[model samples]
Target: MTTIKDVAKKAGVSVATVSRFLNDSGYVSLEAAKAVTSAVEELKYESNPVARSLNTKKSNLVGLILPDITNPFFPELARAVEDVGLTYGYTVVLCNSDEDPEKEKNYIETLKKKYIAGFIVTSNQLDAPHYANAKVPIVALDRTINEKIPIVSSNNAGAIMGTNALLERGCRNILFLRGPEKLNPANDRYEGFLEAIRNSDAHYQVVTCPFHFADSQKIVENVLKDHPQIDGIFASSDVSAAGALKAAGIVGKHVPDELQIVGFDGVAMGEMLSPGLTTVAQDVYKMGAIAARVLIKRIENKEIEQNFYEVPVKLVIRGTTREGME
Candidate 1:
């Protein structure tokens, strides 16, 4: 295989100059850059990434650590991150921690040894000290770690709009299928729901559930069975909404007629569900893209305008909710 030394010889430049030009590190004269480019093209030279990483103490690899891959929301976010990383000539390495802090720590440690360029994390370990001291660029996605870390997320307070839509439809008794209490987004959403119902005449109850369909389905089924008067539901996630829909079907409550439902996270699975899910639609793709971009910029030592990026969200009316009744 052709080597940097050979390229230097062909370009009439020292190996150090060629290395500087290739890495875009130290400044190189225009003439030297032109000669190196020509020589690289002519020789079809491909630098060894492993060696380059070792030499520079960094790799062109970005790590995306997600809490749960089974959730459709995360897969969509992963795709966005991967696409943006490719455009910036970086490869994305996906890690599924299953919301396990230990597993997440292991991944972070392993990647750090490899000199990963940066990370985009969606973790539930908000108080984990690993992130604060990782000594690497990291952008939190869909979750908040700490104020010091940069974050890219949706407007979690958008849940208020969804709750209001239910009230507008004359839902007197609403059930909120809340997510894990430890998650910042879940707390924000619950707070939004509470704010929307604070002065409303509607009766409401909150139940915590994991962001899992089966678990949510079981809890919702029991709640709906015991509280037959519950006519509306605001689920913390599309997965939970699907579970609520399933539970409603089992409990013989016809959606949008006897019951109305609104889900968060405008995941594609929501659109595929029968009757579809009325939901608070967050631009998840944009969140992932922005998080990746921010992490990449930080890794490259570029200035970022802000530390927090909150993408806007809107409530999407669908078959799950009564329309034209508000």
Candidate 2:
């Protein structure tokens, strides 16, 4: 559909002028108003003020740049964002940054050139040097490099929620697994797990994984060989958690009986497992919804000068946790 933006560009007048003319406001000059009217007529413009605002500065569109859209976590979050966006009469543009800094930089530059209203960035690493010159408002999801940009993240207080969930369930010597350490989320969760163990007067071992299935499996296999006393395990992510589950099965260990396991992200795979995986649900869907609302409010609302959107975390007790334990 030919929008008011087309009319403004064709008439060579500012979008505000076209909007004023369309509204029959008295301020627009007679000549400019006539040109806008003629252009609107010729182009069959729909006179949508929202589309006209595209030319002015607000396009009623919010772009979401996620690190891994393929991940179950991201897809659910994306759906939540799109759901909330449509309700507010705004459009969403989805982009995958692939966790590459250069790819992320390119996406920001591309969206800016396309005149997107704002962005909700979900990168793996927290490095956004490109934002120092960003023209539009930006909200970070999971990654926050610059203090100037608003961050909407899960409450990364600690893995105590996940770790303690496993420990209290008779998991004496547990294996705590991890992924890449570039971002603060992983580090924070790891630290929380350690604190939980210390506080509980329990003994556990930490195993570092490379944020992938195969690598984590290798780490688990090595840990199993070195330590046969491990009674429980806490994997950093659902992907790696799945790998841990499979690896334990390889050694003929029954979940929550011979051993207990817990995962993160509350991913779709968690429930499908034999013993549904207990996980620390970060409320990914809510995170995306909150991020969209905050960035849009900060940009559209003239009243609010500053804001912070913080998402809370919760431990989802599923079939994965010990049947009778904590």
Candidate 3:
């Protein structure tokens, strides 16, 4: 393999000049930089990241920890994180904690030892002591973490608008399909749902389940049997909403007539369902981008105006909820 020495020799410049040009550190004359660039291209010299990291005291690596890789929501979020990290010239390392607190802590500890520049976490646990005590900058994605670290999330309060839309469509009683109550986002969504129907004549019920499509489907199926009067549903996630849709079919309930449903996350798969899912659409991609941007700034010792950022959300009307119902 061609080394920096070969490039320096070919460019007729000192090794120090070549190093400066390669790392973009300190300063090298424009002429010297051009010569080094040309020589590097000709020699196809690849910089040794290990050596460079040793000198700079940091690596161009960032860690992204998510609760479950099986969830569709996380995959989309992870894709956005990777794309944004690449644009900033950083490589992202993904870790799936599987909702295990011990696994999450272990991954954080391992990544820190590898000199990862920063972290973006969507933790399943309520407490994040590992992240709190981390040496590098850390940012929360989707879920809020400790107060010291920054958080990027969707507008939880805006979920009320989606619930209200269901009520406007003549749904008398609504069911809120949510995740664990301990999760910050789930709790916020539950609060928003209650606030939307507080003064309305319609009644509401809550059903907590794991964030798996199959598990949610089973819970929803049983709920429909137990409470046949439920006329509408507001699922905290698109996956759960999809499951609700399936349960409705299994129970022989006519969608948009006997029952209406709306979901969150605005995932593209929502449109592919037989009756497209109406939802409170949060920009998951934008959330990931903002998290990466904020974490990068912190890693570079740049000042950010705010530690908490909420990406906007909007209600999307679709076939699942009655159209033109006011």
Candidate 4:
């Protein structure tokens, strides 16, 4: 295999100059750059990534840590991150923590040992101190880790919008299908829901469930069975909204007439549901893309204008809600 020294000899440049040019670490004269490029092309030279990482203390790999892969929303987010990473000449390594703090910690330590360049994290272990001291650039996606860490997320007020939609449709008794209590996004959404109904006369109940479909379905089924007065449901996620919809059907509740539902995250599966799902549509792809870009920029020592990036969200009306209520 051709080596950097051979490239330097072929281009009439010192090995140090060639290294500087290849890594873009230091300035090289235009003539030297041109010669190095020509030599590299002629020799078909491919630098060893492992050696380069050892020398630079960083790799061409970005780590994306997600809380749960079973949620459909995360897959879409992962795709966006992967696409952006590839475009920027970086490979994305996906790590699913399954909402386990120990697993997430292990992934972080292992990736850091391998000199991973940066991280895009959507896991629930943001409160861990190691993340604050990870010494690696981290961009929180769809979750708030802390003020010190940069975050890219949609407006949490989307939940308020969803809640108001249910209230406006004459839903006096509403049930909120919330996610885990400790998760930041889940708390932000639950807070948004409370803010929306603060002065309203709606009687609402909050129930916690995992983002999984089966668990949400089972919980929602029980809630619907015990409280026949629940005329509307505002789920923290589209998967939960789907569960509520299924539960309503199993309990013989006619949707949009007897019960109305609103879900967050405008995932594609929402549209496949029988009446379709009305949702607070967040641009999951854009959030992921922005997180990746922010991480890459930090890795490249570029200036970022802001630490907190808030993407906008909108309420999408669909078959789940009553017509003429928008």
Q: Each model's TM-score, in the order given? A: 0.95, 0.83, 0.87, 0.93
Error of 4 at 133 (Å): 1.7
lDDT score at residue 237, model 2, on the 0-100 scale: 87
What are the per-model C-alpha RMSD values against the true structure? 1.6, 5.0, 3.0, 1.9
The sequence of per-residue lDDT tens digits that candidate 2 reaches over residues 1-326 is 87667888999998778877775444998789789878988998776565456545557778888877787788988998899888887789988888888887888888776677888887766555676567788888776658777887777664788988887798888898866778678887888888888887667888778667777777787787678888888988888888888888787777768778888777787888877888887888898888877777766744444545657778888765666755
By TM-score, highest first, what's the ranking? 1, 4, 3, 2
lDDT score at residue 156, model 1, on the 0-100 scale: 96
Q: Kindly report which residue pairs in candidate 2 clash with one another.
A: 276-320
Candidate 3 lDDT by residue in tens digits, 102-214: 99889888887788899998985667688778888999976666778898989988778988999889988889887777788888888888898886888888889766688
Every candidate's lDDT:
0.92, 0.78, 0.87, 0.91
Q: Pick the candidate with the highest lDDT.
A: 1
TM-score of 4: 0.93
Off by over 4 Å in 4: none
Candidate 4 lDDT over 144-207, as tens digits, reads: 6778789998897779999999998999999998888877788899999999988698899999
* CA error at residue 99 for candidate 1, angstroms: 1.6
Tell me how far the alpha carbon of residue 225 in candidate 2 is from the true structure, in angstroms, after superposition: 2.2
